[model samples]
Target: MSHAPTTLQERPTPAPAVATTSLSSRTLPRWAPLGFAAVAIVLGVGLGLVAGWHSRIQWGLLSALFFVAISYTVTTAVENKRQAKDRLATSVVWVCFVLAVVPLASLTWTTLSRGAKVVDGYFLTHSMAGVLGTEPGGGVYHALVGTLEQVGIATAISAPIGLLTAVYLVEYGKGALARAVTFFVDVMTGIPSIVAGLFILSIMLMAELKPSGLMGSLALTILMIPVVVRSTEEMLKLVPNELREASLALGIPKWRTILKVVLPTAIGGITTGVMLAIARIAGETAPIMLLVFGSQLINTNPFEGAQSSLPFYIWEQYKIGSEASYDRAWGAALVLIAFVMILNLVARGIARWKAPKTGR
Candidate 1:
């Protein structure tokens, strides 16, 4: 009527399958992506020459080959193990970044090449004054001012509301309020810029307000708010729960803790989000056209009258279909890109400055 004593060997724990997964996945070479890209380019060129389809064949081959390489990396690098997830994630991220860079660099080069002639000092300070046909003269001064004023006002409107909404969602909101805010933010994130412009336009019409920089700003605000809210919300959420708990333990109010700890901790991401939001809206053509009713000359007062943003200027002059107009349009595109780049750089600087310190 006796049972044998239990032993640790009898209760042996199951070995993790995760280790097997890591070994399987991590076997792929780190330099696989570069090799794949090189192969793609070479094969694409060779195949293009063989097929006589030139551009399409080369592009098709290159894209197919490059994507294949990325797929290979992802498949091999992501199998089974959860620990290798960081590697998998980084691999995909770098792939995406490289893919994006090709087009971006091409765009920059193309714009700079074509726009260089018209992007001189005069173009920066002068409006599209008395030059026509193939003749080139004048500048995008008016467009610059218009873009700035419109986007600045839009930022003024959206940044506060978006930040507040994120703050509420992060700090105060719960139940229906939080859910509704999240739902709306998600919905707004997908709203097209053209739709925002139309919404503002419709509202302006009903209210009998004339199209101006102010209205353009409102449209941009609509387009910007969702992005800001989402980004800020994510950033705020990244703040450690321990900090909040610590503050509460110190008898600090929840709101004060968020203000002092959470916001500061996530300020870097928040500022970057704000800049990206601004950049997104600043280049919108439909909103500017619908709200500001594009002008050829400088209108200093954003509140008082019609304005012309860089996008609107591009849209306008590109239609003229003359060399002069074409050159000017390219120059405006370059300027717009430059403005966004500068803003992004500034945001990066801010993010670095405000980034939270690490260490336990």
Candidate 2:
């Protein structure tokens, strides 16, 4: 037998050239294009100012150009095609920012310009009072109440059904029924507001809930449900499977798991989605026109009597043959827009405040 040496023999090691070669072969990360973006933006902005483009349109163009330049730079940088990624990214971002600002600025300018004629104290305090002819004065008090009632009722009706349906789809729904619901929700997502109005009108014709704010609420429910379901479903899906497994592992019922863990995790997003759904239907004129039958005077009884809403009032006033009516329409439109803006801001705030912190 060949005697084995007490000291073990060792194989010769290769030089570090292989490791160095491997290291050198490592390609750069794709984020490199950020450099070109910087260079393009600085270059483009200087060029824009040199040209006589001080208008909103000019700003928009410059912004777009800057975005493209930055995007190109980032792409190139990622591919190791450029060296100046940071500056390129910055320029592009600024350009995009400027572009974004222009539209909001234009919208504010246009809305104020057109709406100021109707935004007097009388416009805020007085109902569409004495809006008979050219000399203007009137407000949107009645419409405001109607809008609140209609949207409130819609939220009340839609929230339960939509949220429950989403829960079932996510937690309990199995095969065919779930697929059917998903398909229908997808279809409903794109249902035109006018179609929802028609559907409600047809139902009202059948049961004779005709031309009341209740009927308007019904139409809004149809419009709001799909949005709620879609958003809630997406939110619920974001809940980790581990949460479900852990709750079950603790011998808790599935329902409790959903209530305690899943819902709490996703509640922030759900609330924001619900608010957005409300905003979506708030401005629908067709449904209100068909169901509520807008009036100039306020009617608080959403169940029994016809009511007016800001959108419907705007529609009605704009059609009337009086300058006062037109002015009131613009003023009412501004108020409606303002309300929508506030709702969006509130939703954003709620989302931020309630969102779960991820880190320890």
Candidate 3:
């Protein structure tokens, strides 16, 4: 006997509908920072006046604090906790940046204002040989010459040695000798400029040699070499290992590969480092004062006679304790700063020019 067939029934279960909500955080306007800054400034100025505070610095500090607080609060309400936290951090960073910049800007502005009074054709061209410190008619011509010659000599001596040392450390350094060299380089980096001067001075005394720009250059070379080495080492380390291996696979010698491939690849950074080192030593006064034995007259021969540098000139002028001397000191300071700035600009330009092209 067979059982009768039963009727089959089927039903499809439907998928859940997608649900959406209209409660997204509001986006901050692009001009929010500007608006916040404006409000902060107004409130800060008002509060400063009401509190009888005259210093603009205090006002600015208050404004920065207010901006940060307001930014955090507004972002929290309109956006979310994460956005608020981000805005808070951004505000703090902006405040720190402004704070750091303010003092530098003030110093530069003050220097430009005070130095402009004494920086002129006569001030730049004439020597202080016949002119007295209080007479206000002298120039930095001799000092300028000395600075150029000493720095040029120091750079010429330090750059090659520092670069080679850096190359050795990065390309082939191994074992205790490399470690010792690195340790000494680090130690040299921390030594005071004055200490370097003292070292040279001691050497000069022992050798019975008189103070001269040549001696100053020796001291500067000590202070400059470590900086150059460290910077160049870092640049060399940044070169890709694949490039070196590729050159080796092509039957090129290791030395030739390093010289032609690696050096070219990292030349821009190395040059930048060298220029920075030059700037670091250029404004040093202690070494120059001890070794160069500042001269009022133009000394064309750094090896033969006493010479003057910008820092030494500034020091001498400031020590005279006269209005004219003070002006001259300010002028020298401005010139020195300008020289350093010019060097930085040139370094950046060279780095950009020499940097390898990534795309055809």
Candidate 4:
């Protein structure tokens, strides 16, 4: 009777056991990708040899493909479909990066290896005055000088005008005039260098002016202005409106505010844009050919006589069709590349120097 009234003690339910996995089991090993890559490379080389493929590029491509496929297959088997997809994407990105870098590396190596033979102090300081194109004993002095002068003149003429135009467009532009200016700039951006050269040639012909470095500079100016304008406009647009408003609230005239606050803030980018524009025009051969009338002797006076530039020198040497001429062309090309690289480096330095400092 008492047992009937007594309640049975309830047994506590045990918590369900969690499924445990070792970290190594759930994910790929640290050395897995390297091992896969090594295996892929070995297989690629073996297959290439068996197939009698001569090009190393083919082998590399095959290796990259194998790497991606192997990574996906292994990941899928070891992990899940999602992990395999991620590994596949990663492999694809790495392959793309290598593909992009390989060409640039090859070009640089080719240039350096070939150009070093002729790029010495003597090559830098002399001019192609007396030595025949078939005989190798000349330098790039005249061409270097002409390039610097013409590019300098073009920069001088284009930079201020472009900066002002960009300023007007970004800061003071309001109506149809701004839109028209923008339209013209866009049109000019796509205008062929030869067209600009022809336009300047027409003007020179009208003025009865002979082909000279000045004429070449005018054409380069035309080509450079659009680049500078577009680049500077973008840079100025990146400036914060809040800064402008803050300056205006302090009773600063719009012009003064732009000159002091806006320009200073964006000066780094503006300088970089101007330098890039200079680099863009530096290697233009069409304008130089149409106007500068390539010369063999040094012509420091850009206003009066024909001049030789790096591009013109390269072209002239290439036309000669001699071993010496080929060497000179390669040398000139290397120099031109170095010039552009130096400009870019200078732009980066200036950008860093003039970058706005932020308070912590």
Candidate 5:
């Protein structure tokens, strides 16, 4: 009866479990990378100066190395090992990107600076006809015209053949014949530009043909076809089989389906590939040298006589080794670069315009 007055004691509850670490606590601040880069640059420059290095390239390389090392070390100290490893990978990638870009920037700047001395309205509008290499009065008009003609002819010849060949490979390819064609295309892709020129030269010799823009066009066509085939084949392969099946189920002819449904779906990539092929052939110096036979006059006719192209013109000018010729060479080079860039830009535009529209 006396034990009835005993009371129960309250037990203490366990504390709620909390995380030991958080993303914000484990990661470096946003400004950390910039600060690390600044410190690395200063140290790299200081070391380069102390070591009596003159090349800015050396400074840049050293800075990159220091940046990667400093980032990894700092990250290790402030965070865990895993985050430090990730930061190290990111730093290396950034360094590689800068290294790749710096050379391109330097080359573009050098070309622009030297090329501007001679690239003017007169330079673009006139030709090297009746002008001495030692003098600075000629222009790239003749070369530009020849380049356009030859490349145009080559494109006209190669595009249809390559596109058709790619279609056959993707749509109806099934046999030893297809395999043989694929093998040859692959072989042609690696064939040297010089080899292509030599092959065309052999044909010219057999036919008693003279060197002209037409001859250059033939050589360029050889180089261009393989590129177009490879690129178009890849693009066509990317088209979904479901669309093809649906088209077939609708009782459409296979060729018509490919022409209407498959080609339109991949037209963007196809056009882009063709443009890339054109650009590849556009810069070929060997073919131009072996076939075009470089003209100094403004021979607008590509098939009749020797004609100049930008690559041949640049080579001829540089070989002259005069200040004026060097300027002309640089100017011609600048023009060629501009031409290629325009082609690429056009390709981008065409690709975007032709890309399949998807409803959201």
Candidate 6:
């Protein structure tokens, strides 16, 4: 038996190893996005040509469709169903983003191209008082002065009142009075800019007063107050109750706590909101047209004489029906856009600079 067992070891044989294939292990290459973009462009152009659609809009739509379809098909072939679906969703979001950006980019490009032709130093510094609409040497100096004064006055009138109202609503409001205030604020928010102008115009007429920058400012203030109040209320509401309670727990009065703890915390948002309101009212042509009465000469004193703003200037120039006037209108539009953009940037900067500190 021992001799037979020793010879039996060579009789057995081993099985071969089995290999596995998993779709999850497969993935698209790093260059896939670039390749997909190039292919989409070609397909989009071809489709546009074949369909006799000459517009960029049609080509863009086709390109987006092709990109999404091709991405899904390729991803599904290479990977599993779940990964392919994920890629499809991502492509859709990217396409939406591109669509949103294209119009804004086109607008900016068009404005810059047309505005650059007439925006010179001389155009910015001289008044159109002596020069005719057909002439090219006049500038926006008079309208610029009127706009600055009127807007400054409006801000001065609205900011304090709006802030106080917001503070009351957030910190001390209750019952019927609060509800009434809120209701009126909502109503005022929806009032037409032209209606605000008319309201002021009616009052001015009752007083036998003529159109002036002060009257324009009164209308702007009417429009701006609701915006400021709404924005400030939202900002103030964002201040944590815990912070207010902590101050009160230290024996501080509610008013003092609001001043010391709440206002500082929300100051950045408050300032930004105020600036936004000012920017909004800056381009209102209706109020300026009704109340300011479009001045051709510089009027530094807002309360005394007729005035003009950037918006009114643009309208006046366009209505003049001359090449020089049209050029000036475009230039004025560019300046107005630049001014608004600057305000927005400044607001963003202030918001970032004064954002709440969180130690990590």
The runs of at least 3 residues in candidate 3 whose Cα sits more than 4 Å from the true structure, single-residue gaps closed, are 1-25
The Cα error of candidate 6 at residue 60, in Å, is: 1.4
Tens-digit per-residue lDDT, 115-164, candidate 2: 88778676766676556535566677888888989999999999999999
Which candidate, 3 or 6, would have the higher lDDT against the true structure? Answer: 3
lDDT tens digits, residues 133-201, model 4?
A: 899889999999999999999999999999999999999998999999999999999999999999999
Each candidate: RMSD: 9.1, 7.8, 5.0, 4.0, 3.4, 4.6
Tens-digit lDDT track of model 5 for 264-360: 8999989989988988998889998898889899998898999999999999999999999999999999999899999889888977887778899
State how far residue 253 of model 3 sits from its true place (Å): 0.8
Between the candidate structures 1 and 2, which one is better when assessed by lDDT? 1
Question: Per-residue lDDT of 260-329 in model 1, one digit per residue for the tens?
Answer: 8888889899999999899899878988877788887889999878889899899888898988889899
lDDT of 6: 0.91
Clashing pairs in 4: none
What lDDT would candidate 1 get against the real structure?
Answer: 0.83
**What's the lDDT for residue 329 in model 4?**
88
Q: Please report, in order, the local distance difference test score of every candidate based on alpha carbons.
A: 0.83, 0.81, 0.93, 0.93, 0.93, 0.91
Query: Can you tell me which runs of candidate 2 are displaced by over 4 Å?
Result: 1-59, 66-80, 83-101, 113-117, 120-122, 320-326, 348-360
Whichever of 2 and 3 has more lDDT, that candidate is 3
Once superposed on the true structure, which residue ranges of model 4 sit more than 4 Å away at CA? 1-25
Model 6, span 310-338: residue lDDT tens? 99999999999999898898888888888
Off by over 4 Å in 6: 1-24, 348-360
Cα-lDDT of candidate 3: 0.93
